[model samples]
Target: MSIPTGRQILRLYRDLLRYGRQLQFTDKNYFARRIREEFKQAKNTEKVEDINFYFQRGLALLKNKRVV
Candidate 1:
């Protein structure tokens, strides 16, 4: 699998920050750890048509306020 770019990773990180902000009960640090775990998993997977798909999924989860 191809290594993900810094920009893509940063996008995912940005979404995570936004997601953390939306939470009322959970600590931001916990939410960030969750996002980081998911990113690590995605980076270990096989290559796909678009690298940004992972970030898109994360952003969608943030938009819906749902965990992976």
Candidate 2:
């Protein structure tokens, strides 16, 4: 499979942010910050496998009701 487009990636990011809001965390701010940091770390990803891996990982976390 091909890597997701930028818009698709942003949609996932937004979904993750929304998921963060939906979860009951003691430190919501910390959760949000962590999401931002993870995204930032992958900001320069160009490899298809790497990008899809992260995208699927995020989706799995979302589906399994966990955070990345």
Candidate 3:
């Protein structure tokens, strides 16, 4: 598997942030902070497979949220 480039990771992060804004939660700040924290924790990850898994998992979770 090819290593993901910096741009790809950045794009995924941005997309997650954007999608996170659509979450229908009472505490928007808390939700946003959680998302930021999750991404930040993975910032230094070096494995491409692990990164891809996280990206997909994050996207799935965001997609599952109801936009109320």
Candidate 4:
């Protein structure tokens, strides 16, 4: 797979944050924190293929939830 550019990664990160913000949960803070943590954990990932896999998975989940 082609490696994603910085701009693409930034865009996806923003989109995911936007989606997280729109989530309707009882504990919005917890949801937000989890989103933040997950992203933070993935921030240092070294493999482009792994990042792409995660990006695609996240996109699929967001699309399924009608958030994208």
Q: Give the Cα-based TM-score of candidate 2 against the true structure.
A: 0.88
The Cα RMSD in angstroms, rounded to one decimal, for candidate 4 relative to the true structure is 2.8
Alpha-carbon lDDT, every model = 0.71, 0.85, 0.72, 0.74
- Off-target runs (Cα >4 Å) in candidate 3 are 66-68
Clashing pairs in 3: none
**lDDT-best of 1 and 4:** 4
**Worst window of 10 by summed lDDT in candidate 1:** 43-52
- Please provide, for model 3 over 1-68, each residue's C-alpha lDDT reduced to its tens digit, 9 standing for 90 to 100: 56666787677678766776765754667767877898889888888788888777765766775433
RMSD of each: 4.1, 1.3, 3.2, 2.8
Q: State in Å the error of residue 19, model 4.
A: 1.6
Error of 3 at 55 (Å): 1.6
Model 2 spans with C-alpha error above 4 angstroms: none
Collision pairs in model 1: none
Winner by lDDT: 2
Error of 4 at 44 (Å): 1.3
Q: Give the better candidate number (2 or 4) by lDDT.
A: 2
Better of 2 and 3 by TM-score: 2
